[model samples]
Each structure stands twice: as structure tokens, then as C-alpha cells.
Target: MVNSTTGNRKHFIYTLAATTLFISTYYLLLPVLPLYMQGMGGSKFKIGLIMGLFSASSLFLRPLAGQASDLKGPVKIMKWTILLYFITPFFYMTHSFVLVSIAQLFYGFTIGAFTISSATVITTSVPLEKVGQAIGIHSIALILAKGLAPTLGTLVHTVWGLYPLIAITVLFSFAALLVTWRLPEIKPASKPGDITFRQVLTYRMVWVCSLVLLSVTLTFGTIMTMLPLLALERNISQYSLFFTVNTLAVVATRLFTGRQDRLTQEALIAVSLLLIFLAVMLVSGSYSLITLIIAAIIYGLGYGAVYPALSTLVVLRTPSEIRGSAFGLFTAAFDIGVTLGSVWGGFSEYLGFKTIYFLASFSPVIGLICFVVFLHGENVWNKILMRNAAK
Candidate 1:
């Protein structure tokens, strides 16, 4: 038993390390890609379209990726995913938007598989009661990459330019690939006959959690897709600070949440939606760097808490046999939200960025209301079940 516990602990750390390295490759491109697309003669909507394509493809593949992880083992799926990550960046160097766009699709394929598999590692390694804390710890990898890499990429872009940055991304992914070899091949706890994707999807808790996550990710997608150009257009200097500070706030909040047991998952999620709404409103109204920074901090705090809480809710409600499929759908919701936000932001350019942001601010409000209503209904249903049992 001690040996088993030690082995899981070691693999968990390896998963975190591998994830941080590989995911950094993607986040490193986020800030610079808009400018890269523009330099290739793409218009604002075109840039958005290209960016949206990545998530669109990812949205499509997550279910399959999840299923693959379940059947094939997450470590194997991760190895192939990292190889894809390593290969796709080379396509960006083609200097053609057509090729870059194609590369984005391939690149998009990697994240869903990588994320689903790595998340599976966490969910499987720990007990159900500790899933929330384990997920919180696991999220540090994403938070760090999302926070630090963009800033690093932007700095590199300013200094050495795009090619060098691409080289660095390739190197990081290669490193991630190497790290994956160290991970243990954890077999799924249940066999194929034990659960079905249909069962996973039919669980109301899965959809409810996924939709709530989708709501915030819409704001996330809009910001990541447009923030670089928006900052440039509005003359907001040092805009990279937004990503950096957002990272810090997220890290702080994660640490705070992981140590506490008092806050219900619903409460954490509710606070996240409210903060996201407030942050989007702030971003829409911002005229200067300081406002953006403040918005990032608030947004980070909210986002940091929500992801793990939602994951815990879903994982707790799911059986291990169907967890891969459930998480696939859960994370797919993220890509779809991002896809919609990016595409909408692009096409809505005529409405102005500020107006687009103002429109997106309402997504969280809608999410919060739905989340509460769903929980209330579920609670009522549970009570009815109890009453019937008593009779």
C-alpha cells in the first residue's frame, strides 16, 4: 500500500511537470499569434477566425480524446499528443496563414487529449473526497503556463522576434515529450463494458458543470483572442502584465482554496461567475493599463477557484469507468466556449471591442442563474426521492 501511494505521488508530480512544459508551448503562442496573423495580411475577423479554428477543432476532438484516454491509457495518449505539439509549431514557420491555420487545427488536437489524460491522472490517483484538492494542485500547471508563457513569449517577440519564439516553443514541447516517458502507464480502473459514453452524458451533473465552465471560458476566449490587438489599438502599454498578474492572483487563490474545506463547490463556482462578470465589465470599461491589471487580478481570482471546483463536482458525480468521457465532454465545453467567443469577437468587430466585451459580460450572469436553478432542482428531487423511500 505504501509503495502504491508513493508511486502515485511520483506520477502525479511527473504529470504536473509534463503538462506545464507542453501547455506552455500553446500559451506561448497566444499573445503573439494575432500579430503574426496580421503580419501575414489577415484582417481582424480573419485573425479571430484562425484563432477560433484551433478551439473549434479541439472542441470536436475532446470526446474522442477522452474515450481514447479511457481505453488506451492516458500515458500513451499523452505521448502522441506531445509529439503532435512538437510537430505543429514547425508549420507556423511556413509564413502562410493557410498553413498556420492548418497547424492550428493539428495543435488544437493535442490540448484536449493532453488535458483529459493529465486530468484523468489526478482524478484517478486520489480518493474521491480529495479530488477537489488534488485538482487544485494539478491546476497549477495550467495556471503557470497561462500566466508566465504569454509574458515570456511577448518579451521574446519584442526582443528576438517570432522565429526564435517558435524555436523555443518546439524545444519546450520536446522537453514535455521527454518527461512523458517517465509517467507510469496507469490502466483504467474499469473496463469498456463497465460504462458507456451515453451514461456519462446523461448525468445531469456533467452537463450542468460543463455549461458553467463554458460560460467563463467564453470570456476567457474573447480576452485571449483579442486582448493583444485590443491593447495595441487602445494604446494600453505593458498589457502583458495582465497575463502575469492574472497568474499570480490565480495561484494565490488556488493555494487559499486548497487549504480550506469550508467552501462548498457551488459557493466557489458562484463566486467565480460573479467575479468573471465583474472582470469582463471592468475590461470593457478600461481605458488604461492599470484598469486592465485590476481586471486581470479579479478575473484570475475567480477563474482559479472555479475550474477545480467544477472538475471536482463532475468527477465526484462520475464513476471511474466513464470519467474519461465525462471529462472529455467537460473540457470540450471549454473549447466550444472559446470557439464561440473568438468567432463572435471577430465578426462583431463592427460593434467595437468594447461592445463585444459588454455583450460577453452577460454569459456569466446567465451561467450563475442556471447553476443555482439546477442545484435547487436537484436538491428538491433528492428530497422527493428521500420522501418516497421513507414511505
Candidate 2:
């Protein structure tokens, strides 16, 4: 057996490198994709449809990816998925909006496959006592990449133009593929009986957790898709600064709250959602760029904490044999939420951006309400603790 600390260090290094490269490439492409579409004479509706296609594809493919990880191992699934990072960007270079949209559909599946596998790999690789901190550190890489990628991408586009930016994105993706190639394979746990997908579906906690993730991600999807448009309407084009500040805030909070997973899971989730509520409320009312930036910072703090907390909650209850499947189901739920948010957020032109943000601001509250109603009475965490005590 590998030394626990050494294994964790290796897992952290590989996961962080992969996540950073992937997120950086993703963020670099996000602000420029619509502009590229318009340059190719694509309509607003077409752009929205194309963007929504990514999430739609992921929603359908993530469960299969998870099952594959469970059967074949995460490292194997990751190897196949990461190759798409190199392939997808070549399609973007064609400058055909429709072709690019089709490519994005495949690209989304690539993301789903790798993400679910990565989640499973990391969760299983780390010790249970260190899962929260490990995930927190891993998330910081993505947040940091997100904070920096937009500004750097915009600068590259400004200086060298669109093709060059595309090239840079492709380079980042290739680098991520290389990092993933070095990841150690996780050994699958053997069990006597097999649980079908349908049986996994029977567990109410799984669905509830999935719904909670979906709701939280919906709020994020709305903000990501609409915030730039809202900023444009307000004549504030420097929206990249909002991400920078928000990421910095998240970095700080993660450093301080790295040990929070050891605390009460319910309380952490509740506090995070409450913070998200206040941030979204502030964002909806903000007419100035500075106010919007402040809102982003607060939102980042909440966003950064919620994900790892949710993952810990899910993984803590999952059997080692089906952990990959649980993660896949979780990601599928999030993809569904993101798809709905992006598609519905696109229609905000009709209802208005303010209305959309206002409605989205209440999503976390809905999730909180659901958790309270369904999962609160017995609560999965209490049951797990009791089981461990009995052992």
C-alpha cells in the first residue's frame, strides 16, 4: 500500500493540475465563443441554442460515464475523455457557428465523462478524514483559473485576435490531457451483489442531494450566462474584474474554512445557502460595476464552500463499490440544472435580466426548503455517524 500522505499529495497534484488546465481553457473560451458566433453571422437564438446543447449533451452522457468509471476504473475513463480536449478545439478553428455548436455537444460529453471520473478518482484516492480539505484545495485551482482565464483570454483576443485565442485554449487543453495521463488508477472494490441503476434510483437521499446540487448550479448557471449581458446593458464591459475579485474571496474563505467538513454538514450547507441568497439579492439590485463586483465576491465565498460540502455529504454515505456511480448521478443532476438554467436564462430577453436574476436568487432557498422537508428528519449524516459508532 502507498503511504497515505504520499498518495494524497500525488492525488492533489494531479487533480489540481488537470482541473486548472480544464477550467482555464473553459473560461478562456466562454467570453469569446458568442463573439465568434456573431462574427460568423449567427443569431442570438442560435448562439443560445448552441450553448445550451453543451449542457444537454452532458445531462444524457454523465450517467454512462459514471457507470464506465465504476466498471473500467476512473483512470481509463479519464484517458479517453481527455483526448477530446485536443479534438474539440480543432472544430472551433473552422469558424462555422453551426459546426462549432455540434462540436460543443460532443465537447460537453467529454467534460461530463472526465468530470465524473475525476470526482470519483479523487474521492476514493483521499482518506475520508482529509476528503474535505483535499477537495477544497482541488477546487481552488479551478477558481484561480476561472479568475484569471477571462482577463488573459480577452487580452490575447485583443492583441492577437480570435484564432490565436483558440490556439491558446487548445494548448491548455493539451496540457491538461498530459497531466491526466499521469494519474494513478484507482482499484475497484469488489462486492457480492450488483446494484442496478434502478436500485440506486430508489434511494431518496441520492435524488435529494442531486436536486440540491442542481438548484445551486442553476443559480450559478444563470449568473454565468446572464451577468455579462447584464453588464453590457449597464455599459460595464470590464466584467472580468468581478471574477477576479470573486475568486480571490473564495481563495481566502477556502483557506479559513478548509477544516469545515469536520463540522456539521447541515449547518455548513445552510450557512452557505444563506450567504448565496444575500449575494444574489445584492447582485439583482446593483446598478454599478463596483456593487456587482462586491456581490460576486460574496457569491464566490458561498459557491466555493457549497460544492465540496455537498460532495463530502454524498461520498460519506456512498459505498466504495458504487462511489463512481454516485458521483456520475450527482453530475448528471447538476448538468440537468445547468441545461435548464442556460436555456431558460436565454429567454430572459423576454422576461428581462432583472426578473431572471431575481427568480434565480430564490433557488438556493428552494433547495434549502427541499432538504428540510425530505432529508432533515433522520438525516444521512446522523445515520452514518451512528453506524460508525456501532462498528
Candidate 3:
């Protein structure tokens, strides 16, 4: 039931190529955009607002877009959205916040639609049993972007300045569009959006899985914001080394353990959540640099496995008819968690880092309990209740 025929290799390659370009372009811009906004005389609040707008709009619009993909097909939505990805960057040339904001609105449409449609296409196109493997491959492309794009983006901006960086990103956007065109399109398995936005938003497991991912990401967000400050306070200069080890461990975990057929997606997720808890626990105790590194490795294993496994679980657990909407809801959950975590990181210092890290470490425990109890434990309890009633 676990390892079956992987769908189409050609489509997988195309999807990988398109996502890598799209994700890479997005990642490349992620760090550079704030600097651009700052240079344009935007205040810190304005910069935050500008950055926040992209995610805010993207987060809210996901379900609608997902439903639309179910009603329509991937090709039309993808064509327009991909074009916007190629076009949105030019608006920054105006050096105006209003224009940039508008561009970001369209950017939301670009990514939101592309996310649902591309995921739909990839999942539907693959063999029913290979969803795990397919999702793993997809996550590999994304993880690589997470691993490499920011550094590359910063390097480009540092060496050639913003305009050149913009140009390089623009090129990738266009390349993504081209690659997207080649990716085979899939119509909704459901009859023309028979599944409404309400259905997508209300899917029980999506919400549960989202909470699980959110918990882990919350911990990740905390580390990202706090670790550097923690390092500076401790006078440990090789803070960047944490990222290196973390990224490497994540990639290694995926390439190695992810390929094995020994575990189910749900089981993998459960293990990952445990790793996240341990990682944060170690990080909370880190008075020394070695603890941080060890914590990073543990967190990497958890993160690398959970991401792909959860994606596969989402696709598998949801009804095929409304899978696009399912993916949208999941995406929304993931993004909202990161955004909140980032905000939490900023506010944590007010509470003192030690207290905050301790709380963050403990927070995921709630997610673990809820996920297991609701997803599995509740089922057993229900069976017992039914037997007693029958008696």
C-alpha cells in the first residue's frame, strides 16, 4: 500500500523544474524585497506591511483559488498565474509602494493558484499509491529552494546590487512560466467545483494536519529569530554554521530516510512531531554552541520528514474530487503558522528569550496530543463507545 508505481516521470520532472524556478524566484526575492522597500523610503512598519500583504492575501485567497481549480482546470489558471509571476517583478521598477502593493496582490494570485493547480496536477497525474513518493519528490524541490535560494539571492544582491538581482529573479519567473506551460494539465476530478470553498475549509484532517505543521513551524520560526540573538549574547561567532548544518541535515534526511518504505505517512508525521519536540527542548537548554548544533540536526530530521509526509497524507486523506481545495486549505494553514511564528519571535524578547523558548518548546506538545488523539485515539474510543451502546 505504501510504495507503488510513481506516476509519470516526465511530469514529475516538469513539475520539479517549474516549482524549483518558481520557488527559487520567490525565495530570491524574499530577503531582497525589504531592502528594496527600505531604500524607497519605506519605514520599518511599512516594510513589514508590504511584506505581510503578500502572505495575507495569498493566505485568504487560497481556498477560493483551489475551488476554482476544481471547477476549471490547471492550464487556464496556471497560464494566467504564471504570467503574473513573470510580470509582477517589473512593478517594483516604479519604486512606489502603491504599485508594489498592487503587484503583490497579483503575486498572491500567482502563487496561490499555482500552488493548488500544480499540486493537483502532480498528485492526480501520479499513481494512486505513489502519492507519498511523488509528494516527497515535490518537497525535495521545495526544500532545495529553502536550502539554497536565500543565500544565492543575498549573494546576488550583494555582488551585483538590487537591479541585477531583480533581473535574475525575473528571468527565473519567466523560466517558471515556460516550464509550467510544459507541465501537463489536469481537470478537477470533481464535476466543475461541486465541492465548495466551505467544504475545503471544513475538511477535518486538513485542519488537524495544519495544526501539526503549524506547531513545528512555530518552533522553527522561534529558532530562526532567536538563535542569532542567542549567539550574539553568548559571543558565539559561528551562528551561520547552525544554518549550514541544519540545511544539510534536512536534505540528507529527505534523500535518505524519505526513500525508505518502512514507514507510513501518518507514522512518519508522528515521529517528526516527536523530533520537533526534542529539537526545541534541546534548543531551550542550549547554554553552549554544541547543543544548538545538535538541536538543529534533530529539528532538521523532523522537518525534512514531516513536510513531505504531511503533503502526502493531505492528498491521501482528502477526497479526490476536492483535492485542490484540500491543498489550498493546507497551504493556508502552513503560511498562517509561519507568519504567526515570525510575529511571535519578534514579541518573544519582551517575555525574555528563555521563557519564550521554553513556552515554544512546550507548545508543540498540544499539537501532538490533538493530532494523535483526534486522528487515531478518538477512533478507538468511538469503537468502544459503540460496543457499549450495542450491549
| lDDT (CA) per prediction | 0.87, 0.76, 0.71
Error of 1 at 272 (Å): 1.5
- Prediction 3 TM-score vs. true: 0.81
The C-alpha stretches of model 3 lying farther than 4 A from their native spots are 1-7, 34-50, 91-105, 201-203, 221-244, 257-263, 280-295, 348-358, 377-391
Clashing pairs in 2: none
- Model 2, span 108-214: residue lDDT tens: 88878887777777777677777777667766876788777877887888789888898888888788888888887776543334646875665556777888888
Listed per model in order, the count of residue pairs whose N, CA or C atoms clash below 3 Å is 0, 0, 0
Q: Which candidate wins on lDDT?
A: 1
Error of 2 at 161 (Å): 1.6
lDDT of 1 by residue, 248-288 (tens): 99999987776334347688889889999999999998889
lDDT of 3 at 125: 68
lDDT of 3 at 317: 69
Q: Model 3: which ten-residue window has the lowest total lDDT?
A: 1-10
Model 3 C-alpha lDDT per residue in residues 128-202, reported as the tens digit of each score: 677766777677777667656766776788788877888987888788888777766675566763787666645
Instruction: Kindly report which residue pairs in candidate 3 clash with one another.
Output: none
TM-score of each: 0.94, 0.90, 0.81
Q: Residue 114: error of model 2 in Å?
A: 1.3
As a TM-score, model 1 comes out at 0.94
